[model samples]
Structure formats: structure tokens, C-alpha cells
Target: MEDLVLNWDLGTGGLLLLAVAAVAVLLVLIMAFKVHAFLALMVTSIGTALAAGIPPNRLVEALGFGFNPTLGNVMLLVALGAMLGRMIEASGGAHVLSERMIQLFGERRAGLALSVASLLMGFPIFFDAGLVVMMPIIYAVARRVGGSFLSIALPSAVAFSAMHIFSPPHPGPVAASATVGADVGLVLVTGLVFALIIWGTVAPVASRLIGARIDVPVPDILGDEDEKTGFESRPKVSTIILLLLLPLVLILLNTALNTVASTTSDPDAFKATPWVAILRALGETPIALLITVFASMFVLGWGAGKSGTLVEKIADSALGPICSVVLVTGAGGMFGGVLRATGIGDAVAESLNGIGLPVIVAAFLISQIVRLAQGSATVALTTAASLMAGVVAAGDYNQMQVVALVMAMSAGSVGFSHVNDSGFWLVSRFFGMSMKQTLGSWTLIQGAMAIVGFVLSLILWAVASAL
Candidate 1:
């Protein structure tokens, strides 16, 4: 079912109170007790709904109703994404790509190589995957570069965040786009613009300043053993580029072709072109991804002399984590659906309808408030998206304006990534940072990224309206 936002009977005063209560509980859990975001979100959502006097039996029924459909839509995509990412990693694609990137940048620019891997891998894979698989290489590079972990880690983190927030194939942007009816192509374009701001400008510069203060260890568990898988020093750069660029090129072509058709009236005339239509179908994300997977099987596996079993192993490896995340997110969505069914979403949305801030400003403020309190970016994103779904849908939202609305929601997601956020402690544990240091570095960088996201999205909205 679509995540529709129906109207509610919640009074403005009641909503304000509920909003405050939701914010307070989430913050208390994340910051005070340091709870896992997934748990924290479930806790706060149920807690707030109850506090709002949602009937317990009704709420439970709503939740039960929401489970399957919410999870079903995303379950396959997450699994498929995980499957694709695993094959890329296990096939020694990471090793091959890293070798080539380092060679291109030269040994002196090892930091840059680590940063680039984070960016490129991030495009097609999830953040945790990027972290788990690439961190070892990052550690090796840091040691070779003679820089502190922060130097390499900072750039790598920056790149990962950029891709996580900006790139498709990652569930966040994909779901956000699907939720709001934004064109995938437009979202991609907008996401790319925002990512550049973060990675190209904000992340690299922030790393230089922030990296100076922290020194993370490459955890022994995450460290690479010296067993030479007899992996080649480098795969052909041409082969690597072709594999890497495959999905991006396909997705972009899909977007570009759609964009081209929209700008003119002769749609079928354009579509009638055999070469264009053929490339369009072949270059679609799903087909193109399958192509890349096959390419990796041969290029990185056989080309690099890995056993055939290793190829099978790659596909099997993605299941555990992908299943966990997809299920959890599906549970979260079901939880959201219950909130909507129980009238909590509408109550929350209606309560905020008249706040003095501009719509965008209010969205950011609510997101930041919720984020600081809860520390689950996904929760923040989903919650904000659910609430705003009503507002943006009610208004005449052009395709592009949806980006601003979504970014405002995303801005909320990044606020206060302290104890509640898994990423916060992941950084703290690896970097050996005190809580205070995580706040200084990880917390600050995330907040910085979130704020910048909002500011730029606002700029885009204004420009769009004026046009």
C-alpha cells in the first residue's frame, strides 16, 4: 500500500504536546541510555502512539496489517542490492579496484585512493558493506601513507556518506524517491548535486580539519590477513571501468531518455528509434546490474585466477546482513503504517500544520529535533517522510520540489548522530574516540552535512518556484 497521509482530528495543542513528547523520549533514549536506533525507534513510536491515547488493540492490529506489504516492496531490492555488492567484494573487485586507484593516484596519494574507493563502491553498495569490505584496504593505505586512521577514515567516511545520502541503489534515496513520486532521474540529478557539495567540498575539507584530531585503529577483526589470495596486483583498468560504470551508465541513460521524451510531444517518434530504444531497455538498472555481475564473475574471478567456488561464495555471502537490514526496515515501515492507521501520522502532521516556520524550515526543525532525540537516521527519515507525505501531497508539488522536501527529511535524519546512532559508536569504537570526540567529529560532520543539505534544497526550491 502507498504510504498515504489521511487527515486527523488531533488538535494543534495536542499535536504540539505529542511532538514534544516524541522528541523528548527519543533524545532521552539515544543520548542518555545509548540505545540502538532500531530499538530506539520502535520504542519511541509505540511509546508516543500510546501516550497520544491510541487504543492499544487497534495499534497492534494496525502494526500487524502493515508488516508484509511494507517489507515486501523493499525486501527484494535490499537483497538484490546486497547480492550485487557481495559479488563485487568477494570476486576481489575491491582489491583490483583499490590497486588500480592507488596506482593512478600514486603511493603518495593513498589517502585519495581510499577516499575514491569509498565513493565508487558506495554508488552500488550499502555503507556498512563499504565499511566492512573497504576498511581493511583503508587501514592498509593509511599505514602505507603514514597518516593517522582519521586521515584516511575521514575521507572514506565522507565518501560513504555522500553515496549513502545521494546515490540510488542505496535504499534511502530509492525509498525516498518512491515514497514521494519524484522521478528517479531527477532525484539522481539532485542527489548528485547535493553529494558533490558534501563529498567534493564539505567532506574533503572537513576531513582535513577533523582528521587532525582523531586516530582510529583498524580493528583486529576487521584487519586483513597477509594470505595472498594470489590476487593480481591490478586488473585491467579498462575492464574495471567498464564494470564499475555499467550500472551508473544504464541508470543515467534511463533517466536521460525519459527526460528527453518529456521535453517534447513526439514521444513515440523518439521512442521509435530502434538503437535508442534497444539501448534504453538493455541499459535499465536491473538488466545492467545483471550484466555487471556476470562481468565480475568472469573478469575478477577467472581473470584474476580465483576458484569457481569463490564466485558461488560471493552470492551466498550477502544473505545474512541483507536479510537483517531489510527485515528491520520492513518492520519499521510496518510500524509507520500502524501509526498512519492509528491516526498518529495525521495527528503529528496536523499538529505541525501551523508552526510559524516556513514549511521547509519547519520540516528541518522537526527532523533535527527528532534526530537529536532518537539518533536513528532511518527513523528520522521515515518519520519525517511520513509526516510530510501529507503536506507535500496536499500541495501541488512539482517533481523537483520533492527533492527539497525529502532533503529536509534527510536533514532531520543526520542531526545529532550521538549515542543513539550506530554510526556514532562505530566511529567512536574504531577511532578510539571518547563520546565527546565523537560529538566533535562524527556528530559535527553529520550535522554539517544535514544542514548543508537543507540549505541547498531550499535554494533549489526557491529557484524552481521562481521559474
Candidate 2:
């Protein structure tokens, strides 16, 4: 992959202030002080704008320019994702699947269900989105079958995390594939296989066994504060299953069609066929997502007999996580932009090169520092990846190795999530575990996940070198 060079001449001190200040302060406020990410993001962005020394009217312009586009582009997708998740939850789809899976796993083998759901859910949806959608199912199963939330929810989250960090179709690895000039389809296949293997070999099944001795504190994934008199009427198992798989099918089909089209030898034959053109159109990612969303609506609404009001309510419920994610992403984006603008990226690159550390190692370390200091995984991933993009542009590296590099960054981010990481608090708050218990379980879990992920990446790296 080609290294990215920052365009420094276009950036200025004021612009730098508006961008980095927002990112750094927002992260500090949330992770260090335990401030809510939503409020911290808003205030820090505003502070950044104000610090840039822009005129009041121009500051308003910057705010509008940055905020609206960020919200519109990212948040809309996030909203759709949230609604889909809620439908899966409230429509009884989640309950039915979890219930059935529990029976299949039996008490002796329930942790395996976490691995299964986590692997499937990671294909198209965000990790947190999968967690939000699947957590309730974990909790309900826990309450009904009798086990700590740790037994189910932790494994489920870990499974999803494996998919998120290691798998493709999730943003970082997907973007890394493009940045490194890899074939996307190959990465997708490879990532899924590795994700499933890691989740199986690494996830602590013994959490259930050891949990019996430890009195493992349970965390809630669904903010289901409501008391249930009886189980809500669930949508059919088939409908729930179909809706969940719909997005992935479209994406994979699109990828397959495009590969076939790319290999077409005859120009006349390629352009002449109406069927070929139609297949090309159908395979696009945005279109695939759109098709999945509309399909899910019908399956959950009409097929499942859910009312529009219920769907709307579930959508609103989905907003909390979506909003929290966007604010952090925007702040992170601004930070990346500023690092480029300020010439800090270039200086850092030169310094690393002088010290004889490879660019990938530098990128990995920078991201790790950010993650350790501030606990927002999204922020750590975005800013660090974007900054590393500069280094990626600076040197020629193997396309597949870039994927390995992304895994290193992801591994660095996962371990040692403490007071500063919002996920730490979210898990703590929802599950009602003390900070100590959270450190013991959530902290240990994250650290273990990262360690195992890094080791896997090293193995792949060695194999790539040998090849």
C-alpha cells in the first residue's frame, strides 16, 4: 500500500485547534472524568470551533459544515442499523432464537451459543449494534435458565468483538483492504474464518465454570427496565432469521456478481447484456443495505404483525447507542484532519523512521496510547487508523500485511479499558457490577481478547512472510 502524505499547506493553527481540541478533550472528558460521551463531544466540538479564532458567523458555518454532514452520512446508517436491531429484539425474534439455542447448547454447553450468534452478527452490523441487539437475548436466557450474565453476555460480546476487529465488512478492516490494494472478497472470506477460530479458541468458556466460584456479576445488554409479566409474542423464528441474514446475502451476492463482471473477457458481451447490467447495479453496497432495510421492515412489521408504533418506538430506543457512537466518530474525524493539517503527522512519521521502528509498529503504538489514555474504542480506532493512513501512504507494504496491521491496532485498543473507556462504564452500569468486578471481568476479558488477537496477527504475519 502507498503511504498517505498530509496536505499541510491548507491547514492553519485555528483549524488545528478546532479539530484536535475537540477530539482530545472529548476523549479526556469521557474517559478520564467519566463524563458522558454525548455531552463531552458536543461541548468539545464547540470549544474547538471557538478556539480556532473564527468569527462568530464563520464558527457557526464550521459547526454546520462539520456537524450536519457527519450526522447525515453516518447517523442515518446508524439509525437504520438500530431499528433493525430493535426489531430483532422486540419482535420476539431474539427471544425465540436464544431460547432455541439454549436448548441446543444445553446447560453443559451454553457458551457455544455466544460464539455462534456473535460470529453471525458481526458480518454486517457494528459490534455494539450486535451487542445491543443480542444482549437482551443473553439476559433473558440468563434469567430464565439460571446463570450469570457474564456467562452469556461476555461471550456474546467477545464473539462480536472478534468479528468487529478481525472481520471484514466492518469498517476498519474493510478500509484497510482498500488502502492496501487487496482484493476485498478474499479479505472478507479470510477474516470470517479467522474470527470464528479466534472466538472459539480464545473466549473463556470457563467463565461459566469459574463464575460459579467467583459469584460473577451480571451485566444487562438490553436496557430493559420494564417488568415482564409474560414473554411478548415473538415474531416467527423463520422471519427473524431471514431478516438478520438479509443484509449479508445481498452484500455477498453483490461481491460475487462484481467479480464475475470484472472477469468478463468480451467488452461487447459485458455491455450488451441487460442481465449483467442489472446484476452490477444490485451488487453495490449502498443498494444492498437499502434492500435489506426495506426487507427487514416488511418481515418484522407485516409478516410478524408488529405495529408501526412499536417499530417507531424500538427505533427511538436504538437512538441512544447510535447517537453516542456518532459524536465520538465526528470528534475523531476532526482530530485526524487536524493532525494532517498541523504537520504533527509528518513529524511523528519522521521521528519513528529515525528510531528504526517500522511505520506499522508506529501506527500501532500511537493508537494504543490513545486507547490507553481515553477509553472510547471508536475514537481509538478511527483516529489511530486515520493517522496510520498517512504512514501507509509513505511506504510500500504488502496488501495482505495491511490487514494484519489493522489487527495489531485493534488488539492494542481492546486491552486495559479502565475508568476512561465508556464501554467499561456501560457494562458496569447495565450489569450493576462494582468497578472492581468490572475490572476483574470486563478488563480481563478485553485484555485477553487483545492478547489473543495480536498473537493471531503475528501468526498470520509469519505465514505471509513465509509465503
- TM-score winner among the candidates? 2
Worst 10-residue lDDT window, candidate 2:
1-10
lDDT of 1 at 2: 37
Clashes per model (N, Cα, C within 3 A):
3, 11
Candidate 2, 228-305: lDDT as tens digits: 412246667777667766666665665566556557897557745898667656644455556666676677765556
Models 1 onward score TM values of 0.63, 0.66
lDDT of 1 at 249: 70
The positional error of residue 219 in candidate 2, measured at the CA in angstroms, is 7.6
Cα lDDT tens digits for candidate 1, 68-156: 66466455444555555555544444456556657779865777767776687667554644454455456555655565667677778
Overall lDDT per candidate, in order of appearance: 0.62, 0.58
131, model 1: CA deviation in Å? 8.2
- Model 1 residue 365 distance off true place after TM-score fit, in angstroms: 3.8
